[model samples]
Target: MAIMLSGHVIGLLKEYMQDLVEQARQETSAQERFGFAATVYRPDHAISDLLALLDDRIESEGMQVGLPEGFLHEIWSLCNQASVHVADRVYVESNVGSEAGSKARTRELTYRALLAFIEARGRASAQGEQGVMES
Candidate 1:
């Protein structure tokens, strides 16, 4: 049977994440955070690194996501990316005016592409997991 996170669970998850981030925010110091961001990993590397950080944080914090006996990164990617995609399906918050049509449409398209990419990753991860389980 497939388990699902109820709205309450998601809310608590978000709150829990925010609390963790709040602690990090307090600890890092503003200059350190800026210096780190200004000269840190590239976008793709940052994406994977952030995902890994989140995985570690969730595990360390003992937040039970109720996933099956498999990799947490796979589960986290699906959940987080789906939430991002749904939130951006109408308009992306970060989209600025571009040469496409309008800032709004471009932002929507940009996030649509991101959603597709994340979904593709999820599919590939699932296939690989299936293969591993069968082996």
Candidate 2:
């Protein structure tokens, strides 16, 4: 059962990562042709708040007391990687100022990545709960 759970979690994480990469590529391509300004999206909420929500959901389901520390670390690491990728994309493709553009791109990518990760995790947890209920 633990192995199955682990496999499910890893699959979800991989899908989340692939989605982030696709998003980054699309954003980079858009910025390359036409200079685009960063706009605040609904999913650009605080990471802490998202994590708190996840914690609540996890507790309510009685599946686990807390998210695994390794999962948390991997999420953070992915966010950082996404941020760096955005920064590099903006710097290399955009004609904007170096420091400012890079900073803005980094911020945008970080928030987007966080939002994507949280949404994916939420969906996965919900599915898991549904499975438990059905069983």
Worst 10 contiguous positions by lDDT, candidate 2: 41-50
Residue-level lDDT tens digits of model 2 in 13-78: 444444544665577678767978655432233333334444454456424543454555555454
Per-candidate Cα lDDT values, in order, are 0.46, 0.48
lDDT (Cα, 0-100) at 113 in candidate 2? 53
The residue ranges of model 2 lying beyond 4 angstroms of the native Cα positions read 1-101
TM-score of each model, paired residue for residue: 0.35, 0.31
Instruction: Estimate candidate 2's RMSD in Å.
Output: 12.6
Query: In terms of TM-score, how similar is model 2 to the real structure?
Result: 0.31
lDDT, candidate 1, 1-135, per-residue tens:
223334554454445444544543454466466674323212233234335555675576534654234445454555455555544543443334343333223323433444455556646767887999999
lDDT of 2 at 42: 25
Which window of ten consecutive residues has the lowest lDDT sum in model 1? 38-47
Residue 56, model 1, lDDT: 70
* lDDT winner: 2
